[model samples]
Target: MRLCGGHSGLLLLLLLLLTSEFPPGWSELFGWRDKKVLNVECETTGYEIVGDDFLVLCPGHCVGQQPLVWGSGVYASISSVCGAAIHSGVLSDSNGGMVRVSKKAGMRGYVSKFANGLRSISLPKWSRSFVFPEASRSMAESSQQWEQESIVSTGDKVDGRRLSFEAYRKGFLSSEAKPAAKDVSSPKGPNPFQQYIGRNLGTASRKPMTTTVSPKKMNKDCNVDIAFLIEGSWSLGVRRFESQKRFVTKVVEELQKTTDGAAVGLIQFGHETKTEISLNKFPTLQGVTLAMRKVSPIGGTSNAGRAIDEVAESFFQKSAGNRREAPNAAVLLLDGWPNDDLEVPARVARETGINIFIVMVEGATSEELASGVHGDFVNKSVCRPNGHFSLHTDRWTASSALVSPLVSRICNTERLICSKTCLNSADIVFVVDGSSSVGLENFPALLEFVANVTGHFEIARAGTHIGIVQYTYEQRTEVELGRHTTPEGVREAVRRVHYWSGGTSTGAAITYTRREMFAHSRSGKRRLLVLITDGRSYDDVREPAAAARKEGIILYAVGIAWAIKDELDAVANDPKSEHVFFVSDFNDLKTVGPKLVENICKEYNALPRN
Candidate 1:
């Protein structure tokens, strides 16, 4: 029964190929008989949105937010790769305006580029979940390569279509992306992924099934936990390199001695994908030091989304004891710009309650860094008493020395400056009427009005809170003021909002406050509700208004354009009392908001109950 040498060799080769190439369903799932059907259509005209399939592109999307989207199978396979199902769709309530899903909030996924009609997504097995811009962004090339490595041909069935993966590289061009051939233009540049691509041949194509976890949460104290997602795109260089390493080392050393719950890790990055470190879950100084020591500055664009997935996995996985206790902080030392985006990371940080303090040691201000950050979080420097104006990172200095101090100043020894400040039971919420009469045309002008209005109070006081409740026919919570009292939270709450349609429901919201909301206030602290409307309430705002005011609530109302100034005047506790305001336009509301806040400050219960 002894087999020949060549036969034995052949058998071993087959076994190796079967195990390495296909993990589970290698024999039955895929085969070389599979073929690829490439249907690609390019058009100069942008597609119009008819309904669910064809959605009209919003003007705002092109200007700001996740304006980058293309029809591709990229995101579809992401959930499979991570071994978790992630839903991807825009917000339902969103209109022709910007639509961003809370699910894909942080940066994660492969580096496949997609535009109006051009997109390449390759969710390959090598694409493990991790954090940092470099690892995820590199996926563009890796995915392209994986696409090339795949050999698939489908029987094209409506329900059960079998796909195969023989091998991907198809000389220069075969099928899949008709133009997916790696641009072999240069050996050096930003597109490092291209360099590794070589051609082979075509076969069949199969959609993927996977999940992407955040590097942060995965890298928890289980082993090497703390990680710094350093940006390594071509946009970056030696500029922040030196500072990145120094701060990283400093943080690592500090983390070592402390019996902190997590281990410190490091991951250098660039482009939109790549995780220098996955949620390795390594515990102890050896693992932490090893991870920190392995960071090698290299290629890719800044995609913060992956970092979020990393943290999401790493943060929430901690034991219940740790979860029950007050949390500790995880610091990220980022230098350079995030050329691409993965906002989900920021959301993960918030949802998982991770105290993610980003220290960007670069010349860019907070605004510039914000353009690159995961959740578009603002700087904590600009805070006001009534919670109107918060600072943007653009407002902060970039020098390491200056930036570190600012980071320290913003993040109190316990938690976020904004979150803690409001914890003192003093975040304020203001409901405004931005109907036709009190509206601003452009977003900038509107933001300015909001800024000026929030600017009056001395925010430095025991953390005065600020939140916005905008009403048309309906009401929208622009800023959830109580989440955090720091200037940063204030800005994020207001960043992506606008004054839109709807009638005034002054009374309903007032009732909601009395019944559902304000009652959930953290402690026995004074709450203020300021109302500014240009006209009379569409509903019976009187009874609720009277009820609230009678319950020792600080209720104030203002009248503007065609509004029943007399009725509003009565809504205020006192007509000429500093509690009342009147405005002609949206900008004017800002003026009145500050004045009211200044008046409230004068009623200082904050200083010395002594």
Candidate 2:
């Protein structure tokens, strides 16, 4: 029979009193029970309790189990019904209370901790668990008391001390029943209670009750134009399609909260591609979310490639609210394999300087994602290679967790910088000094620096072209312009450059790069020559450096160790601070690559478009 409210508790008490026999002193032991009997409505929603202590009837399944309790210094081993209630943190050991208990799906991990005077070990992920609507006020007060006394004196023999159940209960009760003054003295080592709590709670201290906090607003300085291309195919039913909309709404809500704000648009694709929200359609967060909610899924075959082309050709146009000055990005959410080709359209989109991020769910495979990205799908999408850009989830329910991470990636300013500059269309040649002074031990680091810088550009024959010239007493072209078009290809070629040892000939390397390497450079593309050396050149660099500049070569000089400042200044272009860089050791070259890329992009952006 279903039961609820104060009436249910009173009736249960009367029935128990009439039908049950009491042990010796049981009446006196439970004198406080006169206030409220156990409520039998374990399924009631929003059950309320007075003060702290009460009783709750457990669901039928929990009848034989030991009560699972967590919190510091709390103990409750009554009938399974009351014990499970206490274990769920609904009832405090101080007085007692009644609460409704509900079953929930098992968690990946459960944190066990002290509740009142009792503690429980962590349950495995597969173990069944129960939850209640709200914790009792007395439980909260008891938890506050525990947090205040979590740290004990260093002299306490808490380390590796195992007490029997009775002994441990007595010690815990005594410690909480009588409070000690706060010990402000510095701890000699880690506190034993803190360590114990950390072990059981899976954290350093008793986790404070989580309060609802507002989401973090996006950075105000980040400005970019983003297009979301979502597939609404028949495989994704209405519910999962709504999940995609909700995810996009959440991201747009956060993006619009910024001062500068990211301009976002949405395109829905199935059998055909349709622009659901134009970039200029919504001016406020509320408008964006409302518009997103109004969009209905058009279930058909997935045509992700067509949607990608739509975003590239139409969504980013000035008439559709594309900000020409801001970096462009397209996020494609695919639920299944595409009906058409992804590589050609994705490549075309990227060629227009739009960064493509692919989110694959359920039926979509990593191979499909790689085809859509058409570049470093794993690494280039985000700053680090954890596959942030190409996200995947096995189930629709878990897609909500991807929201914050996806928004952060889309708003990352550093990753967007290259899209705003002509770095993709520039011809870059690295001039290295493989002289005797630059020990062989340091040569790999120099190559690594070059690879790191090369990673920043979109390496392609029709895009940016990279060449390498290594010199000592003589010069040898390591990689000619347009020889390696892919980032991996360029990196591999850089790794294969054999170290040459002799006198420094920075000027001859510069002259050779201008005459040979720059000859392969395409017309209308910016010509950049990056010079790396550790010592002053044995031959004069001023004349050849000036000659290269006269021939329309932009020079950057990176000096390491004993390299002279005047030579670097002579080799580099004007504005020495931007064109010249120095580090004390070869290892520090890693830090200089990004700064150099930023400068390269800055110069490229400052120039008029061809």
Candidate 3:
């Protein structure tokens, strides 16, 4: 009853063909059809690694079903994880082996690229990825050879005949392998696939990926003063109006749960704008939600421009519970085009250090959204060119989906505040009067004030640069512009400034800063000088202040106890109220610090970008 040897071999081959677990091309070429298949071992380091069969290399809570892999120096979605490893030079296609993928910080900017036979689609910024361990020399050589041979011209078949392992081994043993010829006449650089290969092979330097601040981290770090501007006009029926209220309530709830320092207020705009909730009215989540539920729609014409103006003039005032230290943001939810012009009011709102985010509901056009933005729609003034601040939905029913993304945008303080003003692109010099009048007890307070103001800026050579000048008869440059390129470095340098008390020569300090500290100021960057004094200067400051202003330097005068008002007026720039600040005591400097920063941002925003 036993079958012949040939028949038995044929039966075994058929079984292997039907029960193969390896990918299509691999089983046929490598005779691995009957080999024992092993489940991928996903090792965990504190964070849980999800996906039982396919491992997700990225860190953080893996929210969705898709598995992310590190390919071509970026986080990409590939059809096959093992194939991507081979294409990324982490494994060899000839004989695939175990790969060790470690998680790292999320990065900004991902691009689509091709490698070997695999195609990778880019993931969004702040999306997590993994770090693949270096492959063995033999494996690397095989992967490199396979990559060079697999790349084909546009329109060519990618799944051509697979090369034998012996042939690949022989090619690896050779000194070098030539790649497929590309058309020399083409103007475009090598295809994305080639570039991807070059980056992995070390032929080209890898571009440093910018680390993105996670949403959770951003929520804790950013303090936002947000006002919700709702359009409750006749065009938006009661149902849609209710939907808008629900959306806003949900957003506030999310913010309350996640954000560290957040204040919420609402204004309903129709024929007239009504303040439903002041920024300081409800300090807790329960109160805000209760107030939101009680809001009744005001049926009339939509005067969006007036509502925006109200936000700029009244909603964000200190009386309204607007924190001077927090960045100002306004979320405008509109159902249709406004009857009044939006350009002038929006411009004024932006000029007042308010970042405007517009969400156009059904019946509103993208053109109106563009018009309502702070700058030209193409080049946004506040946020990045990526349209995170503006949103439009074709139907009101879909409004629920906008809450998470909107909350994320509001919490992203780096993009929300720093990108809007001169916080990221100016040179700020602090001139302190370290005289005998300012006793040793007050010196630390003065330094603390300087550090607090410095915290508002992103210290970088290409971004905002900070300088310090401590004057007591003679001026000393404690920190020079561009001396420190990081916030920590600048803060540390400020802490190290030694206090030396002598005579007060405010005029000489201003002149010294202008001559020594600002001599090397970069062109196309805003120049700002902040002068802090406790009393009147022994020497004249009017001429030096005037000279500083003449050279296009913006001056701010901060006077502590016993300081002369006349001197502050003479030292400050035009519109003295905006540029001059007075505090009764040295400890009150903390209260004035934010106001000074807000004013500086306003002045910086008013200047035309170079």
Candidate 4:
């Protein structure tokens, strides 16, 4: 009918002849066989979730809305199905019979009677299908080549002519749009100042997990990403590597335990540089773990720098808002010195703005390296790097797993989880009894107590500052004022604190805190002193109470079993009663930790009482 209005049989026959050269269902026939895409076709409308059969969707006769169906975890909507997400349901609408409702991606389903039961199944962002076989083949071949050579993946317009498909009961043909040919010159990716490296610690569960939906990105300025570059060198030995591998595995498993939206990547560098088993290779958690298995610590050169380079290039592409991000900070786990050129890595660190951290296993020192080795390379990265994967996950276990060093950093400021530290910038110090009554057996518990409480803060926006001072007959400060602005330092200091055995000098410590801490305190600052002691002080506490009250220094006393209630009351800010706590014993110190910190933070809940 083009240019000529009269319908001609010869013209129609010619058009059909041309179209026949490109079969409509050709792609459907070869898609799965050729590994073009996970070819999925539903003889019944709705999704046939992976690992699920008979998951069908058809309209319900209900007067309210369309009916739903559940096969696996996915649900579907099959009312007047145009294009909307589906849900689950029981036997809904009377089908045009039990004939069967069928479906294929990109194409709608047919309800024997109704002509319009067509809808597009929502595919995961990471999951995709081809519109054409030849075009798909071309694109996939290009993508696969890029992948094989460790090249940055790319996409383009695929030719539909070569990918024509005729969707059927089992499969469909798709004409892939021709992809615009591009000359992709593989550039040497920026070296990582901060790298994310981890070995396949253990088998992570690939079972479908409920993924948390990310909030809509407001704009570019506020974006953050991070990755871990793990060292899988032979030097790690089987024993060390095995443990480290386990650590990395758990780190990944637990990452989703907290927040699924926290962008993360994993890189393993040893004798050879490979990241196929890493976060960089796949966008989905399942892809990541699948790749993780193919990985072995083969060809052993401790190329920590090479791993860093790959992470920097592969994951931390353009920065926060460019596309997907690399880690905002990178942690490098190495059993030994870097064998790659340090200057190349240093230059990359400078360019990528990645915060780099170097965690040397077996206590390898910076001095052990050749002359140019600089901790400053990773330390000075703009991304603020902290490296190490503690295979010692059992040191502290809760609902999730994480490397202690990395956990400490993540619990701090920048990305998310800043409420704990950013909401209030109060100055609070932990005063430990450290008397003979507190033995070394119970010391770790105290440190754990502080960690439990203080770790709640993310330490953002000059938010919260926590200090530690332990005293007996004599008082000594564990974490000095202004030592760590971030939560990592505070956690580290608390973990490394030295406990002393001596007489309780509660009064002397109180007096010292009031004079040295409060008297010299900055105006508008909320000074809080939390004292952990077993009982009354040797010296009179009345004087210190008056000074603290006068100075508005909120004093909270946590008594462990033998605590003196009357003396504790006097040390309180007001009726002295409100600030005082009576804990059952040191063993149960964790019970009272959150309460004490909450009380202090409550005051700053408004405008951050400083």
Candidate 5:
């Protein structure tokens, strides 16, 4: 036992090493070796802290694989460094500690460290990298002076990334910590990421995209009966409301100068709708502009559906200033989505010959805009499909910039041609009951309904062929199958149909339609017979209706006041709800016009496209 002081000290150290279990730094050494076994082939990778999170680009591996231990093995072991401080209370006491997910980087990992905490990550000398206009070397130099921290992981896939705490706080990821004008050049102004964000996400891109209408095509003389349906809710503050009014005035002033002169009307809508100017009220551009200036915003909830109904019922009438031959249009200025169901009313407006141009400002969704326009209208005609004739702006001030495109689309009559292309392929015949109950006064309403429905289809010899037959005690052929080649011609023939006031003969009309109206030559097309009667049939309808169905004719029945519902149910195709319509009176026909047209279009659209 007798030994020198240095030997004794060495002996004591050896005993301490042998006796201690789970010693400090030893566990870390073993953990580091274990991690190295699990880690990938230590290839140099790049990472960038986008917002509050870090996007680590793993080359050969995909998401869900183990994260690379980003450091040289020489510095504080991986466990004591990044993994240990996390489990211990040391890093948790930091003031700026808050967990956030990457908003734009589109990764699943959360930021695992803060400020000085990043020092322990042991970023290799070669690990610095970035994306976009900056060169890798320059980015590394700029980032080296600044301490950066964050982490990324992989999880269940979704709309790429969600819950961007940093993007929400700082607006968007900065192109450079300090962007020099000479360093970055992109088609989307200074930031190329602006276009990237808009294309992927439905948010404001770094630089707003502005679209303009071709001026050469804009100045041509054209006649349009246009009504401006504006949002006047409090959310669209007074300044924004005034901006909307100015946009409308500018459009009207330009349109009125054309040789044919467009008739402009105004409707300021919120919880309540006010007719600021009727279409017939102001014939000149000066009168319309002055009227628009005096119109004030009435604060209330956004109810666009009601405004559309008002425009369809009251705004686009002859008494209100609508010309029979002029193309009718309604410019809807929306700041937000409607508070009610917009589909049905929008359908009615379009079926009534009004071309809806939806101008969506900030706060409107792509879904709402798509539902507000006619489903069959082409993209170019409405400026864009899904959100047709729609111009989306980042802020209220940007709405002024949309006037040219809106005017060009609304004024240029050529685009309005597609509004008539509703049905793709069909042989449609109108079987009308010209009974005495549908007197001279109501006969015009009947013809108007027929004209409205006829206008919705593509009336070409090869597209959707149209014919009409008026029935009383006897059936009279008003329009022959494939007789008219254009929608205009078909509508004219419908208008010319004379009222033959007599007794109801629904069965005879159905039999005549099946035997004569649906010719063998037109058998290739979908046969559709729309029967309109106002009273009980004087003759039996069951046998003829069965015969019509047997011949492959799809029957749709519309009955006005005093007409039998049982007869309508019997005459219509198998599903009565899908094929039959009933109105209280002649004036109520417009109510069901859009629904009938919608069903017809739905049937046609569902057909297999060749």
Candidate 6:
């Protein structure tokens, strides 16, 4: 069964009535890594004990505490309640009213709700908001565009603003900040586009609507490597920026508790991508949380593609600390649609063997967010059975509540299943036209296109095997099926084959591919042939293509510049669009790389795993 849940207006209490401790995996799931008594450093004005639940009320500051609010999940404060209160009630000092507690079967604790009687309390002047050191360095140092727009925290700027801790506390405590102007709300409620417009035009501070809280379960599997890619763009705003940091901190807290633990990394990206914490940076959970709390948002455009590329190229590499044996993953917390297309880079990242989970807020449309998910894995696997991988929150603060559920999902990595040989179990052959038309200059482009297609598959004796056949006046088998045992080997061999530069004999190539490459593989793997050409064949291709199809070879015919559409159609597999492709020029071949890889992967996914 799929393991998933959502953040709602109720706290999830893990009851340990007898031991006065959490259930297995509870401490990790709830971000309860710090075992020391949280020094809220405030006077306990009142105390109540019901069963094993001990609720202590404090009058002032709580330094490091996770409070259980009636309608919210845990909040950072020792001033509220210090321990995990599985059973208890809160009494209003100003007014007396009934506090509703609803119990659900199989739930460890009850949902606590006050009847609109709990009022906001006034604070003393002596209480000042203490500023923590900035968590992460600026990410805009490398990008001129980002540097121009970045709101750098300099000279007494704790979090890009000179605000007392009292103000920061009040900002989060206030149920509703200055009623959003009538101009900001629509008949349907608050306008979603308000954040973008208000940010760019410098409108009045539109505080994110105070959100309700919620809760989750626990998972202990530690054989996973996760990297968090967060958007630190200006659009996230200062409050949201801090909220994102908190969410990340909680995830780190939870993941660090497993045996061996999940190796975690952090990447913050705006107009540029910055690696805030490398996967191997901090070996312990305490070190990870401490680093996370210091990360500040470096405002700029959200360029998720570049950030994805950075993770794919660097973060997961062995030299960069990624464990080759673990399942590699990236939890992308995106705020908006990237400035560039994510399809290619994301596909490349997936091809590199890292699973991607995209968490989009209000910034991008569903279609845009879905586009970045590797292999539509969000809909197919991550969100399988029920939950959604693309998490959408009403506002940024609410995103913090997602930490528990997100951790739960990630820890239950076993459930995030995929076919073992999803890209393996395939015998793929490429038929290329290396005539004078595709001169030495354009031939490499054709070869590069073939290389691009070859790069996405797993190349090994027992996995997907690759072969290449070049055709002109004479068809020559360049690489036999299952010959190259690695993608690097296949690519280097393809790159080394000098252009034949002869007459076009496409039919002969098809006949040669069937006779030389198709039947040699007795592996029962899916047979796929990609036929690429720039001109019509000197001989008929129909019979040769038919013979290959009769042998159950899935043919994909790609036509460039001078290649005839009719001949291309006759040569490709039935259901034309799925198998036939036409490109205007050899240079434009790179544009179709993602689509070709995706189609091939789709077919791979359809088959059973080896």
Q: Which portions of model 6 miss their true places by more than 4 Å?
A: 1-422, 607-610
TM-score of 1: 0.31
Per residue, candidate 4 scores C-alpha lDDT tens digits across 1-610 of 2435565434543432344321233324433221122111121112211111111122233212221111112222221121121212112232211111223232222111111221122211111111111112233333332222211111111111222222221122233423322312212443232221111011122222233434352111212345667767766666666555565566554444443333456677776676544333455444454555555666576777676666544454322121211125556665656666544553454333345555545533555456355645444432323232122222222213335445555534333221122123467778888888878887777788878777654342234567788888888888775567666677788888987989888888988877765554444356788888886688888887777768778788888877788888877766454578887677788777655654554444333210
Best by lDDT: 3
Candidate 5 lDDT (Cα, 0 to 1) = 0.56
Reference-based TM-score of each model: 0.31, 0.37, 0.39, 0.34, 0.34, 0.36
Q: Model 5 Cα displacement at 127 (Å)? A: 69
Model 2 spans > 4 angstroms off: 1-420
Candidate 1 lDDT, 1-610, residue by residue in tens: 2447668545533443343232233323333122221211111011110011111112211211112121122332112111110112221112222111111221233443322211222222221121111112222233343333332322231111222223323232333322222312223322211101000001112111111333443332211124456655655566456556655555444434333333333555554334554333343444554665556556665554454444434332322112211232344445534444433344334322344556544345476556634333323211212222221233123333443343333323222322231123344556667666554663344555555445433232233556677777766767665654445556655666777756677777677665555665544455777776677777887788788778667777766666787667656665346667766655555555445544554343233320
Which 10-residue span in candidate 3 carries the lowest summed lDDT?
195-204
- Give the per-residue lDDT of model 3 (tens digit) for 282-395: 646557878888888798878877787677555765445665345678898877677665655565456445777888777645775555543343224233335877887888
Tens-digit lDDT string for candidate 6 (1-610):
1224662111222122222233345446533332111112121111111111111222221212212221222211111232112112232322211111211112112222222221111111111111111111121123223222211112221111231222223332332222111311112321111110000011112221111121232335555668898888876788767767777787777665554467778999888788998767765656777898788887787777777767655576443565433556788876656655466555545433456677755555576567554533333323232553456576666676777677776655434442123355578889999998888878889888888777656565445789999989998888888778776789889878878888999999899889988879644577888999999889999999999899888899899999999999999887788788888988999877657666665555455321
Candidate 3 regions with alpha-carbon error over 4 angstroms: 1-219, 364-386, 417-496, 499-610
Clashes of 4: 62
Candidate 5 clashing pairs?
A: 109-153, 382-389
Model 5 agreement with the true structure over 405-469: per-residue lDDT tens digits = 77787866545532333353578889999998889899998889888777655555445788899
Better of 2 and 4 by TM-score: 2
* C-alpha local distance difference test of each model: 0.40, 0.61, 0.62, 0.46, 0.56, 0.55
